[model samples]
Target chain A: DVKVTQSSRYLVKRTGEKVFLECVQDMDHENMFWYRQDPGLGLRLIYFSYDVKMKEKGDIPEGYSVSREKKERFSLILESASTNQTSMYLCASIPSGLVTTYIYFGEGSWLTVV
Target chain B: AQSVAQPEDQVNVAEGNPLTVKCTYSVSGNPYLFWYVQYPNRGLQFLLKYITGDNLVKGSYGFEAEFNKSQTSFHLKKPSALVSDSALYFCAVRPQSGGYNKLIFGAGTRLAVHP
Candidate 1:
C-alpha cells in the first residue's frame, strides 16, 4: 500500500506569518502536487512538481510556493499567511506522467489563519 | 476548456437502498475518468477509474462507476448504501493526449445515508 504523509494534520497560524506544510510519499513518484480545497470552489491546484527542483504553477498559485529538493518530499510555503488562506491543503502524487495513472493523497493539513 | 461537473450538490438515500452520484465531464478526445471519496477532515480516496476496456469499473468499499462515452458521464454507484458510505464524492478527468497533464476535479457531491 502507498502512503502519503503530511507533516501536520492541523495548524493554527496568525495573519502575516510564514507557514510551511510538508508532504512525503513512501514510493518514488515523479509527480507531486499541492492543492487547496474550499467549499463550492473545490480543489484548486497551487503547485506541482514533476521532478526535483522543477515546479509549475497551477490554477491558483498566488501567495504560495513549493519546494522539491528530494524525490520523496514536497513542501508548500506561504510567504505571508492571511485569514483567507485558511483552508485544507492536500498533497498528492502519481507514480509517473501516465495520463491513466491515479493519484495517492495524504491525510491533509487544515490551516487556520486568524 | 476541459471540465468535470457533478450536477447534484447533495444526495440522500436510506440505508440498504441503491445510491448513485452523478458526474459528467467535457473534454477533448478520450478522457480518463475517476471517482474519489473524501471523509471529513481527510484527503480524497480513489474509488475507481475508467481508462478503457470495460465501462463498468469496481473500486474500493464496494463502489462502482459506469463510463458512458456518448453521454460523457462516469457516475459512481453502489448496490447497497450504508450509513458509513456517506461522504463527499468528487469526479475527476484527465485528457489522454496532453503532455504532463493535470487532473481536473468537480465541486463534489455530499452523500447522506440514513438507516
Candidate 2:
C-alpha cells in the first residue's frame, strides 16, 4: 500500500510569519503537488514538482512556494502567511507523468493563521 | 486543459436505497476519470479509476462508476447506501496525453445517507 504522510496535522501561525508544511510519500512518486482546500471553492492547486528542483505554478500559487529536494519529500512554504491563508492543505503524489496515473494524498495539514 | 463538474452539490439517500453522484468532464482527448471519497477532516481516498476498457468500474465499499462517452459523464453508483457511506465525493479527470498532468477535481458532492 502507498502511504503519503504529512508532517503536521494542525498548525498555527501569526500573520506575516513563515510557515512550512512537509509531506513524504513512500512510493517514490515522481510528481508531487500542494493544494489548499476551502469550503465552496474546493481544492485549488498551489504548486507542483515534477522532479527534484523543478516546480510549476498551479491555479492559485500566490504566496506559496514548494521544494522537492528528494524523491520522497515535498515541502510547501508560505513566505508570509496571512489570515486568509488559514485552510486545509493537502499533499499528493503520483508515480509518473501519465494522465492515467492516480494521485495519492496525505491526511492533510490544517493551518490556522491569526 | 482538462476540467470536471459535479452538477449537484449534495445527494441525500436513505439506507438500503441506491444512490448516484453525478460527474461530468471536459477534455480534448481520451479521458482518465476517477472517483474519490473524503471523510470529514481527512484526506481524499481513492475509490476507483477508469483508465480504459470497461465502462463499469467497481471500487471499495461497493461503490461503482459508469463511464459514458456520449454524455461525457462518469456517474458513481451504489446498490445500497449505508450510514457510513456519507462523505464528500469528488470526481476528477485527466487527459490521456502524457506529461506532468494534474487531476482536475469537481467541487464535490456531499452524500448523506440516512437510516
State the C-alpha RMSD over the true interface residues for candidate 2, after superposing those residues.
1.2
C-alpha RMSD of each candidate structure in angstroms = 1.1, 1.3
Which stretches in model 1 have alpha-carbon errors above 4 Å?
B99-101
lDDT of 2 by residue, B1-115 (tens): 5678898999999999999999999888787898999999899999999989999999999999999999999999999999999999999887766455456889989999999
Q: Candidate 2, residue A86: CA error in Å? A: 1.2
Give each prediction's DockQ, rounded to 2 decimals.
0.77, 0.73
Candidate 2's C-alpha runs over 4 A off are A97-99
What Cα-based lDDT does every candidate model obtain? 0.92, 0.90
Q: Which candidate number would show the highest DockQ if scored against the true structure?
A: 1
Interface RMSD of each: 1.0, 1.2
In terms of TM-score, the best-performing candidate is 1
